[model samples]
Target: MTARTLHVDPSNAEQARSWDGEEGSYWAAHADDFDRALRAYQRPFLDAAALHRGERVLDIGCGSGLTSRAAARLTVGGPVLGVDLSGPMLRVARREAEREGLDSVRYEQVDAQTYPFPEASFDIAVSRMGVMFFADPVTAFRNIARALRPGGRVALLVWQGLERNEWFRSFATALAAGRDLPVPPPDEPGPFAMSDPGVVRDTLTAAGFDTPELTGLERPMTFGRDAERAYSFVSGMLAWMADDLDETGRARALANLRVDIEAHATPEGVRYASAVWVVTATRP
Candidate 1:
């Protein structure tokens, strides 16, 4: 493992560990699959960014560098720095960038919550389904604000409430297999942390950003081309759900998951409805 350039915030230590360990490894190994799942949102999210030529970009929690690479192309020779806590994902990101000949794109393994970024160094900061895992969102956004030049913009695509997301609801329901699973509080550091528009607005405001514009976006996230493939992908990603189950219980959960996934399969692909908030704010 490469040494991190800066200390991770104590609140983000567990997140750092997970994203740098098994979870990160899974994401890295299935980089293409994960990217394909979220590909539907890329265009709209990038469109909202409105990247200009020669504009430097900072991509927070940039897993596998897909968004960074896309931003690099839009920047037209500008530098794009992608920072994340996952060493495995960063390696994949670097390899993908090199493969694409995006010399202006770079990846670094660092926790965005507390990384000592050069102040006012970037023209734009963006995150796609990222920024939600920050344990101390206000502090993290403040740090991000300090990294941006005056009038610099920040664009983020974050999940909406868990109930509105069919992908998560269906999966969790299937995997629970009659067991009651508690949902994390909406304000906690997780995918749904920023699901509330009110919290997002207040967080950015407290972090020295202009009032943010929150736009709701709905889309279908592709899991795979068929039920079998989708089951393999999703089960692998979410296998931890069955960790506490006995062998028979685990089998039952897996069966339930397969059935649920198969129900959603279509000729085009196995896709599930998803909702997100596309938020854009500027550092004053």
Candidate 2:
């Protein structure tokens, strides 16, 4: 295999590795499943973006190009470029776009935090559960601000906190049963780094974006069609957390996770309460 070209921040080296390695590959393989799981947030995210015809769009961290394709449908006269750190996910995105005949959608493997996007190249920038992984969020948003035309808008969906999101809270506790999971440092690059509204506001303001309008919303995150399916899916997604465990420990974690999942099972499907911050801001 030829080595891939990387246009990422040195600080994001660890993330690039995880996303480009096993994590990215797993997501690529389960692209459709993951999309279905996150389907609830799509409409809310797009509604906030308010995309229009002929409007250029930038989809930051556009994994598997699902959101990118949705944006492309609105802006047929303009292009939708989805940039991500994972080459595997980008490939899956490209394949799906071609299969769907979405000619206006494209995916690029680039770090949105530091990518040299052309000035005033986009009318809107959006991310669905994508903007929170930045090692240097201020620089990332600053770069994004520079990419947009004056008055261009940005809308994103980020998780609120561990306590608020039942999906992570339940699974994490179950997965760490009988084991000690160290707490991550505050402001560390992870899913919940942007959870605090005050930090988000400060970061955006410093990044040259107007004060962001943050709306908190709660919705169900679909796990699977049933408890059995949900257990398998959830286990696979969180399997990395048990990498350090022995075989017995891994099995115990899965056992605990199954019980936790069973409690949330519904006739419609396995649903978990998820909380998010739907933030919108304008480039000024």
> Highest TM-score: which candidate?
1
Over 243-272, each residue of candidate 1 has an lDDT whose tens digit, in order, gives: 999999999999999999999998889989
Q: How far is candidate 2 from the true structure (C-alpha RMSD, Å)?
A: 1.4
- Cα lDDT of candidate 2 equals 0.88
Best by lDDT: 1
**lDDT of model number 1:** 0.93
Colliding pairs, model 1: none
Error of 1 at 161 (Å): 0.4
- Per-residue lDDT of model 2, residues 1-284, tens digit only: 11145757898878888888888888898887788888888898889999999899999999999889989887764799999888899999999899999988888888889999999999999998888888999999999999999999899998898888888878888989677786544498888888999999999999999999999998898888899988988898889778898999989998999998898889888999989999999998
Predicted structure 1, TM vs. truth:
0.98
TM-score of each: 0.98, 0.96
